[model samples]
Target: MFSRAFSNPYISKWIVQGAGIIWFLGTFGLLMYYGVGQAVAIVDALIFALFFIFGVNIIDQTFNFYVPSGRNNSMLLIFPLLFSLVASYFHFQLLRWIFDEESLYLVFLREVFLLRWAVLGMAEILVALLALAVSKLEEQKEIKNREVMMHELSREAELSQLRQQLQPHFLFNSLNSISALTISQPQKAREMVLQLSDFLRGTMEKDHQQWVSLEEELTYLKMYLDIEHVRFGHRLEVVFDVTDEVKQLRLPQLLIQPLLENAIKHGLYGITEDVRIILRAYKEQNYLMVQIENPFDPEVAAPKGTGFGLSSVGRRLFLLFGRKDLLESKAVESVFTVILKIPQHK
Candidate 1:
């Protein structure tokens, strides 16, 4: 059980105002009916309104202390009744003091208990019940909010795990390329290591970022391409056709890297005279469009990776935007194309 004079500010204000009106009307009506002078009746009404409001607040707090929600003890009912009786006795004495008339004490005390205290006690009980309802609702809201926050944290943890997996997978592939080059061309192998260092440094700087500008992402991609460029030499070629308008538009960091890596793995991995990887970016009305196209031998199966290539891209885009249809892939003739329709974030 808790004692409170109010549940909410608006409700408390209106309750006090309404109770004051009722007290003044009742006091003035009774005094006027008993042939009291109008001046004394008005004075009595003002004093009665003040005392009644104060006494009602005490009754409300008393009932709240006894009649709390979600509990039903017989003792709870007895406490409020006893407290109301005591409060009524004090209110009667206060009125007798204000009126300065000892003869009126018995009649006033009788009226206080039988009429005023009965009505106000019931009103106080209702107020306590209303407070209980409000408290229950607030508690429920807090619980729901906490659950949502925990769910979001869990989701972020899962995404972080997936993101963490990408770095090791990429590092392993890069180290293998460096190993293969070290046996044949030690100079190129050392150059690839330097490029890898720069690339990893850039990646480390943006490790905490979920999104970056298209230009910034492209800068990181080029750092990656520098290493692949040394590995492939003239055998691998890339053509970038991006619009100036979409250059500064924000995109998920490392979103297109896996797709580009998959393209390189599929196209120029084995037998290649010359392979061209076409990369394009532009704005299509409200969405930013990115496309990657590469040639693959239809006779041979696509290179198997650690299952974090195109699927990872699709999953990440879905997680970020809540749209499953944003990443589209198609194989037409000898060319495989992946199209990304990213919603522009303002």
Candidate 2:
């Protein structure tokens, strides 16, 4: 609490000003003690302290308008020296007028004139340097804040672009399927159209959301899978093995869809037999872990297309969590597996 109080600029400014006043009072009092006696010494100290405070105030206010930089910083010393000379002259004249009859005290004041002027000059220079440092610090803080904002905006834009790109990619494929089914299977194509409409509506709603519960995301994934089921029919099969404890945990919205899409594209495409894709989710230590497994025949050449789904998902994970190790994929014994780790923040 005490440290916080002192860190406040208003509190610190007043504390410094108070200390300066006390220093002027004590120094003047000691200087006048032996020559002028206690009664006159007190009065002399008070008057000189008032004049010193006024001079300090003038220096502070001047720096508020203009502070020297680069080659001009020599003005730090020059300004104080000039202010001290002027302040000392006025103080000396006032003291002489107030104590014209005290010859001993007048001699003492003259003797100490140079010392008082030097002390005031040094104090002013110190204050000027402090002001310059504060200005530079504020500038640096503002620049850092601006850089952070720009980075956030860039990340958000890229995420939006990825979302937009995924939608059209799926839409074009669905449209092709619908075109194929128009003459042969009109009823199933119409059903797929309705499912597509619902899935696109959910996507629009989730675009403004950053995170969603695992249960909600699974429901959204079910909608997407329904549309895919219409396209591939019984050849594509998906299994979910999610634990109840992890259903309430949150992950990035639409994070799982791309992985599932990739699995189906590689697993079922060009394969006549039924292919099974498994998705498992559970909590492990401080992370919500999810794993997807699918089988592919290595002997057959995979579909020729750009691999945007996996790359975009990986980029999104890195941007959100600042970790490259969150998403991992490996192919072993013709079985392709993807493991994703989401850190749980309490």
Candidate 3:
């Protein structure tokens, strides 16, 4: 409780000011004792301390309005010097009036007039510099806070744009597939339309969600795959190799669908035979590791399309985790594989 009270700026300032006033009174009291008697010395010290405190407050208030900088910093010394001279003059006059009959004490005061001015000047100048430093620190803190807020706003805008782009890209492809099946297989086209509606509804619901359990993501992926299955018929096959333990872990919402879409596009395009795409997930220490495997022919050129899915996912991962190595891909022999690692937060 005491530490917390001192942490407050107003309380700390008053404490320091009180200590300084006590120090000034003690020092002047001892000095005045050499010539004046005890009662007169106490009066003299009290009056001088009042003038000293007033000079310090004036300096503090001046700096509050305009802190000197660059060429004008010389004002810092000049103001304190002038204030000390003025205060010392008034203090000496007041003492002389109060102790008109004390000739010896008057002589003592005249002798130490310059010394008192010098001491007060130094104290006031120290206070001015401290106030200037505090002002500069407050300015710098505000600037830093503004910069962080702007960066956060920029990041959120980019993430929203990336999410919006994915929906239209997948929608166009689904609409094209449905158009192709309308004449020859009207029933399948109607089924795909319904599946597409459900998938889009789920996507809209999860658009604002940043994270979800692995099981929830898998359910959303199943909806997406249902639409794809209608378009591909028996040629495309996807196998899930996820355990119950892994399904309880969490990942970014809709993060896995793009990887699966990439796998299907590369694995099935221009291929006449049936293809199997496998997705596996498990826990590896502090991270949840997910890997997708698909077979692709090197000799056959894949269909040309915008590679936005993988790139957007990579960008999203970097924005979320500040790590570029979280998403990776490689091809070995005829098998293509993509690996994604998500940090598990307890």
Candidate 4:
């Protein structure tokens, strides 16, 4: 009842403010006609202003925001008019006594008492309704703003979790390669072990960072591919085609690793024919473009994929860039390609 009625702040404040303003104007007008002291009138208006600011307006907000039960809402519309009449009566009586004049007494006895206070109090109620309307509008705006902020924050948290998932996922996959090679090609496996150490150290070294330069990502990619090369030898081939200019651009850390993992994951498996994976990067228009291409066995690849790497990269990109249109995956001949467009950020 009371809770539902004052459901809007603007309405409530406007009501209180309207009451205060009427009290203000009527008090001001009466004193002007009666020629009362300026100091007293000013003090009176200030007192009412502070009263409504802290008293009615601020207090009403508690009901509106927190205890918005249907039982309590009717108080919003009920109390203001009641308070206004009481306040008006006291104000008129006070002015009558302070002026101490027969003409002032007669003014109230005839016309002023019947018309001035009642008309002015209604004016205050209307103003209060308007105030509530405006307050509700502003409140809604603030709510929407807060929702947008929360969604962005949630996405960032998800990306952070996914980002952490990459390092261990890559390590587990690479370790398997090294484990397989260790038993068969002992000397090559020894070289891979050292590369694995450097690769893991480099990846884990930048643990707290959310972003890194293109050069740093390239270094990590090269180390990873080097270890894979040592594992597959001639069975695996990788080429980097990147321009000099875009090498220093910034990107979310650990981005390329998952894409590379995807490339390798889809590029090889159950094939007597050799496979070549090409990774290329360049600047096109306003975006930094990266493409990963790999050959052989698409039908068996998706089953092993578990749908994590490239799609996760796409989600992470949207969480960061606010755009999901930046990624593309296509198959041409026996090769599968993952193309990414990262917007240039300052």
Candidate 5:
């Protein structure tokens, strides 16, 4: 009956806060019953007040540290009983010495023993309540962790589906370029096919890894860009600024391709002006700083697509690193930028 409602930190803290009121009532109750002039009674009550606080904090840690289910409840009862017995005995002995009328010995013994039994009963109920609260918290924690795991797995599956969708779209575009080249320039058509094959080989080789070294992913992306450059000619240009120390650090595969595609498609959609894609990668303290920015065309609205590419990267970053604060996208006038910050793993 005591285990479920007040098991988590929110409820547990509330219970402890309420215990402050309980402690006040118990201390004042004992003081009024025993009389304030009885110094031993006052001191004994104070000791028990301290005991309540200590018992609560210690039991919270012990139960939550995972003492094994079978042995846990036994330890819970044993600790409070032993502590109370010793405290009650001291309380009784101190009173006996103070009164010193030997005839009252029997009466004192009689009353003290009865009081000890009552104290034990109260202690039992309190300990039961506390242990129950701790048990509930542990169960709730396990449930929350499980929920997080399931969410991450679902996101991973969605990402896989998105990658599949993208591959075909990317391939179809490149194939059209090769088809055009087959008639206009036969020699260049053969070279484009070789590059296409190499690019597909790289993509197929990475079917398992969600992440790869920056250098490795960059190499693959450059192959794809080479094919696009051949098709677009002077219409597209790419500039890469990467630090030597961070090239070997691992990052999500194809992290920059979507951003590059967004830059060219939207940044140059309406006008015949040449579009430039600049990608920057460097280390800022302990973080991997990646920025994909372009001077977007002010005259054109956004392009037509699924509208999930940038958001997919944002969501993936948040899920992978547990960083609700890291991924950011900003745009003003002619410039649109996506900033990706992930913990650098060497």
Candidate 6:
């Protein structure tokens, strides 16, 4: 109780101010009404202030213990009032010990102790209730803040699952390639099936994560490319030029794969000659830049894709980063290039 009363700045400040007021009143009243000497009156006031302050501090601690239990509200009031009355009686006895009991008999009989106890008790209860109300409001605000945070997390998870959905045509094409390879190249067909299985497993694992290290994402992409490489054979070639520093950086799961799929679909659908797909990842200034370029003959290849892959990637990037300029694409002659800039977080 003593520790809590002294540690609380609000309670401590009021107690100090109350003690000063008590000292001033006691010194002035004794000098005016009882014709006491200045030294004696001041000494008496000092002792009275110290003891009164101690009693008020103890009352504040007592109320603090009872305010939390709703069933103890009545007890909270009764206990402090009784304490004040007992303290007032003690103060009356102390004053008699300090001064002449015969001289101050009339003053003690005027019932000043009862009035002082009543006012002090009421003030103590009011301060305690106000502090309790403030504490309750703070707790309510924290609970509301936690609810808002949880709602946002659930929304993000739903959007992530949507973005991870596999395109139907991609699955159909892979299956057809596997069936054709099974006849003449059973070994390659078996290898492609294993690669496909690993790729899908990695995708499922990454779907549950918001972000993954660049190295892990690239490993999953490599498994996917192995399947596509077996389908196209020598006609498709992929080159990755990633910096060592960029490998540890992270980006949203499955973020880069859609861009590569679009490149392969638009760049090598009907072409016959060998074509190289180039991927470059590096840290540029404050952004992690990834660029993909592939060669496509406009005359031989079918019309460019419906833009769904790139559009979906862009939408997901905007949702994650809240920026439109992060994903960009441009085609110059026979070569199509796509660039993604992910902000580097400290």
Candidate 4 structure quality by residue, lDDT tens digits, 235-266: 88888898889898877788888888777767
Please give, for residues 1-346, the per-residue lDDT of candidate 6 as tens digits.
Answer: 3234355777767756775686568655865576656665666566556656665566556545544667756665776677667766776677677665446643742456677577556755655565456445655776999998887787587566547554454666688889999999999999988988887777766666778889998998888888899998888888999988999998887788878888887777667778799999999998889999988777774554446668888887876777899999888998989999999888
Please tell me which predicted candidate would have the highest TM-score against the true structure: 2
Q: Please give the RMSD of candidate 4 to the true structure.
A: 5.9
Q: How much is 237 displaced in model 2, in angstroms?
A: 1.6
Give the per-residue lDDT digits (tens) of candidate 5, residues 74-190.
655666676666656665676566545644443644476657646754665476565766567768887999998898789788778767766786777678888999999877788
Least accurate 10 contiguous residues by lDDT in model 6: 101-110
Clashes of 1: 0
Give lDDT tens digits, candidate 1, residues 284-345. 98888999998888888656662367888888777677889999988899898999999986
Compared with the true structure, model 5 gives a TM-score of: 0.56
Clashing pairs in 6: none
Q: Rate the local accuracy (lDDT) of all candidates.
A: 0.76, 0.83, 0.85, 0.70, 0.70, 0.73
The per-candidate count of clashes, in order, stands at: 0, 0, 0, 19, 1, 0
**Candidate 1, which ten residues in sequence have the lowest lDDT sum?**
1-10
Ranking of all candidate structures by their TM-score, best first = 2, 3, 1, 4, 6, 5
TM-score of 1: 0.83
> Across residues 99-190, which tens digit of lDDT does each residue of candidate 3 receive?
99999889988998999899878987887777677767766877999999999899989888887888888899999999999999999999
**Candidate 4 weakest lDDT stretch, 10 residues:** 60-69
In lDDT terms, how accurate is model 6?
A: 0.73
lDDT of 1 at 214: 93
User: Whose lDDT is higher: candidate 1's or candidate 5's?
Assistant: 1
Can you give the TM-score per candidate against the true fold?
0.83, 0.89, 0.86, 0.73, 0.56, 0.63
TM-score of 2: 0.89
Per-residue CA lDDT of model 2 for 6-91, tens digit only, reads 45778856765696679667865686655567767777777667666666666666656775788999988898889888888888
